[model samples]
Target chain A: MLAKRIVPCLDIKDGKTVKGINFVNFRDAGDPVELGAQYSREGADELVYLDITASHEGRKTFTELVKKVAANISIPFTVGGGINELKDVDRLLSAGADKVSINSAALRNPKLIEDIAKNFGSQVCVVAIDANYENNDWICYLNGGRIPTEKHLFQWAAEAESLGAGEILFTSMTHDGVKDGYANEALATLAENLHIPIIASGGAGKMEHFRDTFTLGKADAALAASVFHFGEIGIRDLKHYLREEGINVRL
Target chain B: MDVAIVKYNAGNIYSVNYALKRLGIEATITADPELLNKADKVIFPGVGEAETTMNYLKEQKLDVIIKNLKQPVLGICLGMQLMCRYSEEGDVNCLGIFDTDVKRFIPQKHEDKVPHMGWNTITQVKDGLFNAELENQFVYFVHSYYVPVNEFTAATTEYIHPFSASLHKDNFYATQFHPEKSGSVGEIILNNFLKL
Candidate 1:
């Protein structure tokens, strides 16, 4: 059986790990390479490094961080944020990152998805969508949910799958920092509509949230930041809990 | 041992090199025939489409060198697929090192996702690359196409159905999963192969 993954996302700014609540008011976590290595030792299924930095030098620093992460951590990891073109993807992958996740750039140019899949194979492309629940409809957002787009969640996810995205990492801004639970209703719908795997992001407080996401949302994986960063949740303990709850997880 | 990673026109070879580095072995990555032939063991790693990679291998004469190698060779992911007799991916012929054919996974239900991404357990392990410690251990896999369980299957994994997780025939061994990226268990598997 394919185990449900527990991912610890490390949001990078100026080459340091930081976690923000609802995409604002960031707090320093620790060094990315060290944090990532700790997570790996604790039996984290995978790791995600989201580079939130905007400067060109920051981008260069992020690549160096990626190299260090790949060399130190044995588990597979994905690198995202500020990936606008094919060259960016190449740079990260060449640095030994297992996969590359694209968010805003993929939305602005849907063709980017196809080009990545064609050149590097679909397994290498992970399309991350950030959205908010408004007006009884899930509206897509860009720039870390600061700007809204006309695209709806379900339709855009279907389009991304058709456009050759190997996986969809959907983060609901409405429940991001609530620490209540995941947007299971919308997530289950997306899982049903797309053939590729769905990674549920945001709103993960307890082990039950992961269980609910896997059972109700049908998510193949669950990603969280602050909870895992602040020692609020231990990955090994979480996996043991999930396994006891009948959710398949790598122990 | 002089370990050399066969480098053709393929992706994701760097991770394999890094994995070996973690084991304290600085394996050489080269497309040169001389280096490959001279190595004690050769690792043919890839992550790309079948037909295109096969074409590139032929153009660079890597296909012939790989087929004629006498040392132990391990193929991973697409490299494993290319070792088969044929692949449905690009509707092309492969190196025929293993008497099997690769087929794209068809989703049987809503949950049977393609690319079988993430960690999955492998069973029925019996080969030089696998030991008692590896039985039923989870490994990382991310691919759309798979080789069906057959005579050469050294291990099996169940997703939509039981498929070949690893194949062993004589000195050639191949795994559908990326052992290098599979964490600690992956480290053990690579160590086993290196010791062989």
Candidate 2:
């Protein structure tokens, strides 16, 4: 049986991790590489590094950070942010990233997804979408949830899958930092419609939240940040709880 | 010396190269027959349509060159399938390095997914690339087609049915799983191959 993944996301800025209160009032956590290794030992199924800074200096720092993280951690890692072209994908992959996630870039040039998938295989390409409920419909957001797009969540997800996305990482902007729970309504919609694996992101406050996302939302994986980073919940304990709830997890 | 990884329209060669580097061994990716033949060891990795891959190998005359290699050779995933006599994928004939046939896994019910994509434990039947250290370790696998268990089967894993997880004959070694993506256990397997 396939194990339901538990991922710890790190927001990297200028080569260091920055944790915040509601994606603002940021504070330094720790070294990205060391934190990645710690999470791996704690039984994280995989890790995601989102480069929050796309400035010229930040780009160089992010590349080095990826190399350092890859050298330390043995588990599969996905890198996102500033991935606009095929060359960007190649650069990160060569730096030891197992997969590259594209978001705003894909919207600008949908052909980029097809090209990368054709050259490197769909298994290595992931499409990350930040969505929010507006006007009684789920709408897509870009630039780390700062910009809005007219594209509906379901339509974009289906298009991404058809364009050869191996997986879809959907983050609910409304429930992101609230930690009340996942946007089950949005996740359920995407999971029910998409053939590719759907990773539910944002609003993971408690261990039961993960269970609810997997059971109710039917997500393939649940991704969280502060919950796993700040020691509020350990990955091993989370998996133990999920397993107790009859969820299939890697022990 | 760097090992040569055959780069002829194959899948997952970069991962193989990265795995070798993790084990502190350098590797070169090449499609040139002369370059591949002269390397200390050779690896052929693939993940694609069988008939098209076989045709590419035939056109390049690499099928003969690969079979004639004197050094240790490793084939992964589709690369291993191409070494077999024939594959049901697109009804293609292969290099015939191993006396076997590759068959697609047919699910009795609709629930069974075509691609068996995840980690499964292996039961070592005979020592080959794994030695005694990896008798019952789990390796990552992602494929729809598999080679039936046979004399060349060095390790066995069960999915819908028991299938060959690893195969070896003479200097040839192959695995249906992606060792490069299998974490530390996979690194050890690559180290064993490098030492061989």
**Chain B superposition TM-score per model:** 0.98, 0.96
Per-prediction DockQ, in order? 0.87, 0.31
For model 2, the DockQ equals 0.31
Model 2 agreement with the true structure over B12-70: per-residue lDDT tens digits:
67667767777877888988889988899999998777898999999989989998888
| lDDT (tens digit, per residue) of candidate 1 on A103-193 | 9999899999999998888888999999999889999999989999989999999999999999999999999999999999999999889
* A192: Cα error in model 2, Å: 2.1
Clashing residue pairs in candidate 1 (N, C-alpha, C atoms within 3 angstroms): none
Second chain of candidate 2: TM-score?
0.96
Q: What is the lDDT of residue A119 in candidate 1?
A: 86
lDDT of 2 by residue, A18-98 (tens): 866655778788888889989978888789999989897898889888877776676778999999999998889878787
Worst 10 residues of 2 chain A by lDDT: A18-27
Model 2 regions more than 4 Å off: B1-4, B7-11, B26-41, B47-61, B86-92, B99-126, B130-137, B142-164, B192-196
| Error at A134, model 2, angstroms | 2.8
The sequence of per-residue lDDT tens digits that candidate 1 reaches over residues B126-152 is 968899889999999998899999999
Question: What does the lDDT read for residue B190 in candidate 1?
Answer: 89
**Two-chain DockQ for model 1:** 0.87
